[model samples]
Each structure stands twice: as structure tokens, then as C-alpha cells.
Target: MLIPAHFEDLPFDPQRPRAPRRQLRLESEGSTASGETARVLIHNISTTGLLIESAVTLAQDERIELALPEVGNTAAHVVWMSESFYGCRFETPLPASALGTLELFSRVISKAAPSESADTLPVRIARLRKEQGLTLEALAALVNVSKPTVWAWEQGKTRPTPERIAALAKLLGVNEDELLSGRDGNALAQALNQARQVVAEAFGVDPARVKVSIEL
Candidate 1:
């Protein structure tokens, strides 16, 4: 889980440490003044700015509007660029609540199955549904999907979208991590590596320069 930390006190001071940021993988859409919308992959986010990758060409200082979930359209300007990746500064910093929502959405979107899971994702979803005393129809209603869709998910014929996964995890009273990766400890190492890579790319530095330490 991501803790919402304030970034109001921190400015863009090169002499001081950067504001706290969270690594995430969120698929969202953005539009430029040309009214062309493109899919964007959000790599990480902070109150002040974010790192994103897209196939669409964006020049430095170019303004774009992102269709962020729950937060609606957010305006930002490109601050730097590296190949397909772009570092952007938000026109207005996100609030703590908005940051929390984005973090939750990111977790739901970026989950990967553990390599040695005892059960497959479909089996785990079915088991969790049963454990929650929910029928197929009941779960479908709760997740705002059709019964056939829920059945398909359980049958492994189809997978839920990231938004639906978030809703399903909440309805089943499970963390997104637990639902997707079975809460494997190895996931922590993977998460750290991903974080380091995101930070390194955002700053245009070597990944080795970005060290992550956990207090607990």
C-alpha cells in the first residue's frame, strides 16, 4: 500500500532531496491541443509531477490533458523527454485523497501472477468468491459486470479489465496484491526493481543511483 505524503514543503530544489514519489503502472489516456488522444502508460507519480510513456510525440513545454481515473482531466506540461518517455509537471498538485486513489488504481492495473502459485488466477477468484459467500450472479452484480462475464473470468476464458479488477478486489475484501500475486514475498523484490527503474528513467540517471530502503 502507498502512504500519501505531502509534497507542499518541497520545491524543485536541486540542492535538496526530491519530493516523495510512488512507483505505479497505470494505463490512461491523454490529449493534446490537436485533439488527438493517445494511450499513455504512467510509470510513476508524485504530487507535483509524473513520468509517462506514450507513442504519441510530445515536445517539451507542450501542454496536454490526461484523463485520470476518479480525478478526471488533469492538465500538465512536458518538462523533459527521453525517447518515448516524458516527464511532466502537473499544473496543480494532486491532493492526498486523489493520490491515494491513483495508487490503488495502479496496484490493480499492474499485478502479475506469482511464478509458483498453488492455484491459477481463475481458481483463486472462484475460491475467493465462494469464501465471500457470493454466487456468480451476486459477484457479477457487485462488480457491475454481467453474469456471463463473471463466469468467463472464472473459466479463464477472459480476464477482467484493471478497473473491474479493482472493483472485484474491493467487493471480495482482498488486497489487489493478494488477489493477483497471492501475496508472495518475492513480489517485493520485483516491486523494488521496478521502482528503481522508474526513478532512474525519470531522472535520466543510472538505476544503481536509485536505492530503495524499507524501514520495516
Candidate 2:
């Protein structure tokens, strides 16, 4: 086994509480069968499963291999995906011991239960704009852009450039990260899974049945 030479031992702090459960953003950058490098964000993951949101579409039951920096590598089955995102369940469980090494590189690592909020950039922009009490026209005036541009931002059909993001942050009195990336990929996956269960229960069927037949 190759031990990461950079991992350092820190005195455990009881009060710190194992940090929050580190959330991982799954990213895929490889050529698909059609020969295009598909980039995707891995929304959520456990030892047994992973939720991915990618630009490329994957059919259910399609088998694919994944390159994980932490867990070495593995294969997965496409359990679900939309035009822009997909969820996958691993074919096998990752070794528990690997979690420790993974924590070192993860963006969000802690012990808390994974949050289940569904975050989308457009929804976040709309919510923050409303919270700040900035009218679309007012925001447009502040950004020196047209009102229609602001509308497109809220609708999520397009993304603002770095300069536009800076302007939006200035108008909303928030940071760039807040204005740009409010949605947590992991949280969104949990919400999707929960919602799927609730709907399945209401309809008196297994969740798997619903997924197999549901049209993307």
C-alpha cells in the first residue's frame, strides 16, 4: 500500500467533532463511447453508491469505469441520470480504510450526516436576489446590463462570466462563491433520493420500479 507522504497526524480535538461528513464532487473527464471528454460533477457518494451530475447523458444499466483519486479506481453501473446529471451505484464497496486517505483531499470532510438540500445555481441566484430585495431591473441597472440578462441568470439558461459574477456579488452584497455555487452536489443527490422514495411510497411501489420506467 502506498501511504500518502503528505498526510500528517494532528492531535484529535473532541470539541471539533470529526468535522462534517466530507462531501465529494464527482468529476468525470474522459472520452465517452462517442469520443467526447465528458465532464461531470459527482454529487454524492457513500461506500456503496455514488451520485453524479454530468453534462453527458448515460443510459440506465450502462456499465462504466471511474477514476477516483482516493479509492484508486472502480467500476459503476448507471442507476440514474438526467440530461445534465446522473446517479450511480457502485458495483462493490470501497474499503473502509480508504476513507481516511480520502479525507485528506476532499473539499468538505466531517462527521455530520450528509445534508439533503437540493442546490441549483439558478435557484440559488433567485433566492439570494429575493432575500436582498433587489428587483431584476434594479440589479440590471447596478450591473449595467439589461433586465433580460438578469432574467436569464435567474432562469439558469446561461451562466455569467467572472466579471458579471463580481458585479452580481457587489449588487447583492455577497461573496463570489455564494453568488456562484450555492448548490451542494451531495446535498442535491440526497434530496433526489429522498423525493424518489416519498413518491414511490405514495404510489405503492418500489423505488427501483419507478426509476426503471420513469422517462428522463
Candidate 3:
């Protein structure tokens, strides 16, 4: 389960140390001048939420879509914002695969090895759906897909289409990226290496940079 210690209505102090910034584009906070897509820089992120720099002014609790690269378009919620930066949380806490993706992009460059056929994506799907208390038939009916299709998805005999991935993410309350990739021990090691930065936080600070109120 995820904790509500994000940048929501919770108590926030703007003196926390944050992870390195990441450059990526995604869809969220509604349509922009260039359509519904918004290109933003991620300041910090965790399993629970992320802090990003965006021009979009998002109201509290506003839900939006994001086309995460490698990952997919996922539903996200705005918890709080200050200046050009906003704190947002995934509708569902991201899975390890999605976290690995974040860890990959947070760096200046990344190289990934091909994965084995015995990937964890299918396992993740099965686990998430069961956690949601939906049987194969029930989930298939909910998504207008056949039971065999759902079974294939769970068995890794096939993968979901982008559109279906979007639907699955929303239906299962997860980030689309979390549904897209699966990894093994190597990916886990990389994620851990990328996440080595320790947080430095306190209550007081100068007004120059955006005060880090929440921990990632």
C-alpha cells in the first residue's frame, strides 16, 4: 500500500534534498497550446509521487493523462504546486518496472539489456488484477476483451496494445509504464544504483530555489 506523505494537503516543509532532474515529455494537466501534451522536467520522484517543472497550472486533485516514454500514457493526480513545479502522484503506486523506467530516465543516459522470455510483466498483471478482486472473466468483460486475451496477457503469450495498455492502467489503477515493462535482477540493480542519492531536508531555507516541502 502507498502512504499519503506526498505534496497533498499534508504538512510540507520546503527544505528537503531531491533527486537529480530528468528531461522527458508526457501528456498531463489537460491540453496545452501544443495540444494535450506537456513537456516537463522531473525534479524528483519516488514510488509514491513525483515533482516536476511544468507551465501548466493544475488545480488540486485534478486528474490528467501522461504519455510516459517507454512506459505508456498513465493517469496522474495533482497534489500541489509552487511556481513552475508541481507535485503529482500516480493514480496507483507504480510497480517496480515503472520505477526502473524512472530510474533509467533520471540519468543522463541509459543502456538496457534484452530481457528473458520469463518476464515479470505478465506476473504483475495477474497480481494486480487479483489484488483488485477481478477474475479473468470479470476483467475481460470490463475491458471488452476476450477471456483468452486476458489469459494471454497474464501468461505472457501476448502483450497488450497501446490503447489496451492505457485502458488496463486506468482500470487497474496503475501507471501505464508500470504495465509496459518487466525486469529481472539486472534492472533491479540499475534502479538501486540510480537511487543512491540521500535526501537532505530541513524546515528553513533561502527563497532562491523552490523549497522542497515533500520527500520523494
Provide the TM-score for each candidate, comma-separated: 0.36, 0.35, 0.34
**Using alpha carbons, what is the TM-score of model 2?**
0.35
Off by over 4 Å in 2: 1-37, 108-216
Predictions ranked by TM-score, top down? 1, 2, 3
Q: Judged by TM-score, which candidate is best?
A: 1
Tens digits of per-residue lDDT for model 3 on 78-153?
Answer: 7886555567888876665776655544443212211334447787788789989999999999888877678668
Number of clashing pairs, model 2?
10
Model 1, residue pairs in steric clash: none
Task: Judge candidate 3 at residue 178 and give its lDDT.
Answer: 65
Separately for all candidates shown, the number of backbone clashes (residues 3 or more apart, or on different chains) is: 0, 10, 4
State the local distance difference test value for candidate 2: 0.58
